[model samples]
Target chain A: MSLDQNDIAKLARLARIRIEPESVADLQQRLGDILNMVDTMQAVDTTGVDPMANPYDAFQRLRADEVTETDQREKFQAIAPSTEDGLYLVPKVID
Target chain B: MPSYTVAEILQKLESRECSSEEITQSYLDAIAKQDGTINSYITVTAEQALAQARAADELRAKGDAPALCGLPIAHKDIFCTDGIRTSCASKMLDNFIAPYNATVVEKLAAAGVVTLGKTNLDEFAMGSSNETSFYGPVRNPWDINCVPGGSSGGSAAAVAAGLAPIATGTDTGGSIRQPAALCGLTGLKPSYGRVSRYGMIAFASSLDQGGPIARTAEDAAIMMQAMAGFDLRDSTSMDVPVPDYRAALNNDIKGKKIGVPKEYFSAGLHPDIAAAVQTALAEYQKLGAELVEISLPHTELAVPCYYVIAPAEASTNLSRYDGVRYGYRCEDPQDLDDLYTRTREEGFGEEVKRRIMVGTYALSAGFYDAYYRKAQQIRRLIRNDFVEAFKQVDFIAGPTAPNPAFALGEKANDPVTMYLEDIYTISVNLAGLPAISLPAGFSNGKPVSLQLIGRDFDEAGLLAAAHQYQQISDWHRQIAPHAV
Candidate 1:
């Protein structure tokens, strides 16, 4: 159940988060401990059981497609972290 | 007027006994005086509450008011409320203003419930103690030094302190129930899809559910009545007809079969909590409830299955917050990779990051089958255990938390013990059944709660059983002793 630094870093990448290098030893131990805690699932016998993906038990009703909310682009973009010319500006995705 | 449940408040507003502004101001004043020490609210929307209250009053004046008109409620920070800061207690979302109300928020507002404010919770609803909140941990009103059980700690604390008549809370694990128990209030987690999840910030979406926290089982029932309904926007929203929850409040539970999970009574259970559960069972016996000793052999596996399933889902659900769309973004990023990395690193808290790591690892390309899929298969097993137990009983009762309020930081470093804190409550979520927590009695001077879980979409039975217990006992009315 022990998590090495490399594994911890990989986990960070998965979560899309960053942990300080100094915080890794602690995170590793803690993650290992958490894995140990969640390890109880290993003992359960799930024979003949289907994974219950959702609690709902109905088919979705399709509706005629229609626009709902009227355009409020100005109001919507008012809260954007950064905006320019009605488009959200961000770091370049392509070089 | 101030102490009425959400139902009673609406009734009064409809009958013209009090204006919505008066009710809103009274609750706001109560919070202003009391919430300083409790630290329950992260954002107090006095202006919005008044505005909504005024609107509700106008509707009432015209005699065309909605059912929950003018009733104020606290929203969990996890829900995306329009124009309001919807930080899921993570630095990453601290600056993120929701472009729209969470579907639940929109629905509640449509019903005319006034917005009191947003309540505090574990940062991204990750930890058992509210200590992980970047905003700061909320204190248990009962004992300030004692930590309020989280991640819905603030919602529980607010209701307990009489800050709001009721507040909405989300439970990923036992977040709502455990806090309700520790804070001496009532909290319900409806069947997973019974309430819409459209705008709720995902945290183990399979396990995450939004419900009500209130001072009494009756109040919780009233709030749940409005909050539970079908929604087209939420793909997981149940198409089942919403029931008249208030009418079912007085339903007979005589001769009802109540299951006591033997595994829940095993070791690690605090002696004090054990006594409270025993007493609660005795009261249920007085109400003609037949207690059956049942076994959920896979009870221990719930934590693991949940961690695996929740994180896997959380991993996917949370992927949307990649500093790319709407929330926090890193400044002056060297490249896309750096932008994603720096933005995330700077935004999420330690616990949120840890879960992302675990979820990411489990759901990774190479390990998906062994970790994610296998865990899901086992989730079925954990649920089957409930199915087998429920076959012999209509509902199950157990200790909500192994012990009452623990000191802050007691288990902060020990995530295993912390996860185990949810042992009794997690299984219900895994099985997608409705569960409720109510104050059973006091143990070791701290309040304890009895957890009652029912079949899918069976909140009425859960509330009936909980309300039945509350009727015979005054535990729910007991206030935490030392407060500010």
Candidate 2:
């Protein structure tokens, strides 16, 4: 149930959140404590229990394919950090 | 006007004893005068609120305004408000202006309620204490040094401090109820799917439910009347008909069976809180409700299960906050990875980042079954315990929180201790039931609350019982000295 420095680094990479090298040990300790708390669930006998994902156990509702939203590109894009020609601007991915 | 309950305020408006503009102005004045030390509001839309209040007055003068017309309320910043900042008390969305109104805001507006402004909350609604807020911790109105439990802390504090008559709050793992308890107000977390979550920012999808925080259950019921219902925009919103919450407020609870779970009164519960809960139960007994001892044996695992499920969901839900679209973006990025990592790293707070990392690890390859799946399976068992208990009892009653509000920064460094602050209230969320936290009494000068959990979609019954309690008890009437 304990997380090491390496595990913390791996989790940070997977979650796409950078952790400063100095904070890694602190994160490892805290995350390890949280995991220890979560480890209590291991004592329970959930062998035959179905994992309850939703409170109501309801399935995702489906509607017929139809255009429901109006194009608000201009309105929506106005709030973006960087945009050009009605598209969000980000670093170039191409070689 | 600041001292009046929502019901009293509505009555005054109905009788023309006051104008909506006058009421709204008084509250705004109070906020300006009192909120500096309390720190409840994140954004106060004074100009917009007055304009809306004047329009409400104009409509009322014409004689066809909605029931709650002209009443002012605060929204927890987690709910999006078009043209207003919806920070969720995090730097991530601090600059993000919601392009459209949340369904809750829309519904309340349609009911003629004026928006006082957006209130503060724990960052991304992730923590038990409001201290996690990037803006700063919300000070408890009862004791300025203490926290008003969170992530709905600001809303609770606003109402308790008489800055607003009522406020909207979301309870994922006791956000609304815990703060209500600590701040001496009534807060309800309607059953899962009872309230639409359309534009209310998500923390844990399955458990997040928006409800009202008011000084009394009658006020909460009035607010809930406008809040609860079906919405097509939210797929999880129930298709059930919205009941007349106000009409059901006075229904007799004389023969109601209130289940008192032994697990709730464990050694960890403070003596003052336990005594207050017992005193409240005695009052319920005086009103002829029977207290039946019940057991929710899996109660011990609720916090553990919730920590896993909530963080797991948060990790996925927060993935949308990349640097591209809206919200906080990093200074410079060499590549796409840098853009994503640096944006999130700089945007989120410590607790939020911790949760994301924990969630990522839980949902990661090879560990999914051991952590996420196991937590979900235990979640089922925990829910089953409630289901069985409810079969024998009409409702469940206990302390809203283990103790009263702790001083700010006391538990900030220790996440687990803060997580345990919600131990008593999280199980209700796990079971997806409606529950209300009403001011029971004061514990060591801090407010204590008694929580009542009801069957799914039984908000009317829960509110009625809480309303009945408020009728005879004057605990809810005790105002914070700072507020006074």
Highest TM-score against the true fold, candidate:
2
lDDT of each: 0.83, 0.93
lDDT of 2 by residue, B1-484 (tens): 7879999999999999999999999999999999999999999999999999999999999998997899999999999999998899989988889999999999999999999999989999988778888889899988999999998999999998999999999999999999999999999999999899999999989999999999999999999999999999998999988889999998999999999999999999999999999999999999999999999999999999998999999999999999899999999899999999999999999999999888888899998999999999988898889889988999999999998989889999999999999999998999899999999999888899999999989999999999999989999999898894
True contacts kept of 2: 0.88
Candidate 1 error regions (>4 Å): A43-49, A55-75, A93-95, B1-4, B7-17, B482-484
Candidate 1 displacement at residue B1 in angstroms: 6.3
* Interface quality of candidate 1 as DockQ: 0.58
Candidate 1: what lDDT? 0.83
Each prediction's DockQ? 0.58, 0.89
Isolated chain A TM-score, each model: 0.84, 0.95
Q: Looking at model 1, what is the TM-score of chain A? A: 0.84
Shift of residue B244 alpha carbon in model 2, Å = 0.9
lDDT of 1 by residue, B411-455 (tens): 887777788889888888888889999998886678898999998
